[model samples]
Target: MKAPPHFIRNNEEWIIWLLEAEFSGSATPHALSSRTGISLDTIHDNFLYMERVGLLSIERDPDKRYPEEIARVNLTENSLRVYDELKIRPDPGDLF
Candidate 1:
């Protein structure tokens, strides 16, 4: 399968890591970078991009956990809906 777009890969990685972290009860950028080997800067930059595209939600609330969180990435519902519109599956794969 063709690799996901470089940007998309980064964004997806971020979302995956963010949810993983949240579920694992750890939501720190440092932890994410350490887990995914995606640099902190890249993660943060792509996060803002994802946020703009509405694929990620970055909210700030005084009562919210991690109130000063730098990011809160996830696959927005719209993103999943868009995926259906552009769906393509790999034929089959084994490294040539």
Candidate 2:
């Protein structure tokens, strides 16, 4: 599906749209950073902000070894609804 005009207004929204379209239930800030070339700090901050705005949820990764702190991010139901409304989908040409 094609994303509607103004569906993604900025990099942060693009990241959220990407999460909703491609990652959904299994995403991490580090992984998103790797995928989108956005900085980890920016990803983390956006995750937190999105969570606050009820667009996504952040949870501690339970499978992490030792004391490393990592988060698993998931799009909330509201975010899924927004994605559906926007007809957002990953661009095959951009997948890597």
Candidate 3:
């Protein structure tokens, strides 16, 4: 497995980890924000970042104009390989 890059943010990694078990590897930004106690904007940013890096595939209507409108965030095939190489798990603190 390829090693996860140091540039990957904790929240980004957490989002990927959560996606693995969410609706068969897909979920909406709102769902992820609610589950992680993170802000929707933050989730959107992470999603975009992952998407830019080829680690995620976002499903949305062609007319959708905002990241928040994303219908589903699916893990890319490469995501699992990177996840396996992740050496750190994000600390959820008391959010759990």
Candidate 4:
């Protein structure tokens, strides 16, 4: 599936989710969606793309990616740093 127009609009949310997860010891898709407002569908789809592209690691639990076994959004060192500097959540009604 094609990503949402704004799915990659700002790298902040993506970076934050990954950084937060890495720092917090792993996170679920829900965490990323809640922070980014990218929608669960979008998150999963992009995650799959990330896996396909090998930017990060991806493991499935019966064809599903769960926090217990994997981080939905993986953060590289750069992403982690970007997230550390990023503040403020995206405004409501701006998720599209």
lDDT of each: 0.51, 0.68, 0.74, 0.51
What stretches of model 3 exceed 4 Å from their correct place? 1-9, 87-96
Our model 1 lands, by Cα RMSD against the true structure, at: 6.8
Ranked candidates (TM-score, high to low):
3, 2, 1, 4
lDDT by residue for model 1 (1-96), tens: 123323333455445434433444225555555666766677777667766877666544455343235644445666555444334422234223
Could you give candidate 3's per-residue lDDT for residues 1-96 as a string of tens digits? 133334446787877766774457888777788888888777788888889999999898777777647878898889877766553544345245
Q: lDDT score, residue 85, model 2?
A: 59
Supply candidate 2's per-residue lDDT for 29: 70
Each model's TM-score? 0.49, 0.67, 0.71, 0.46
lDDT tens digits, residue span 6-90, model 4? 3334534453444464446245666666655667766666666655654434445565444333444455555445444443445
Worst 10 residues of 2 by lDDT: 1-10
**Model 1 CA deviation exceeding 4 Å by range:** 1-28, 60-71, 81-88, 91-96
Cα error of candidate 1 at position 50, Å:
0.2
Better of 1 and 2 by TM-score: 2
Error of 3 at 69 (Å): 2.2
Q: What digit string (tens of lDDT, one per residue) describes model 2 on residues 1-96?
A: 334235456665676677866775568777777787777767777777787899887787677732224467787788777767557555445566
Best by TM-score: 3
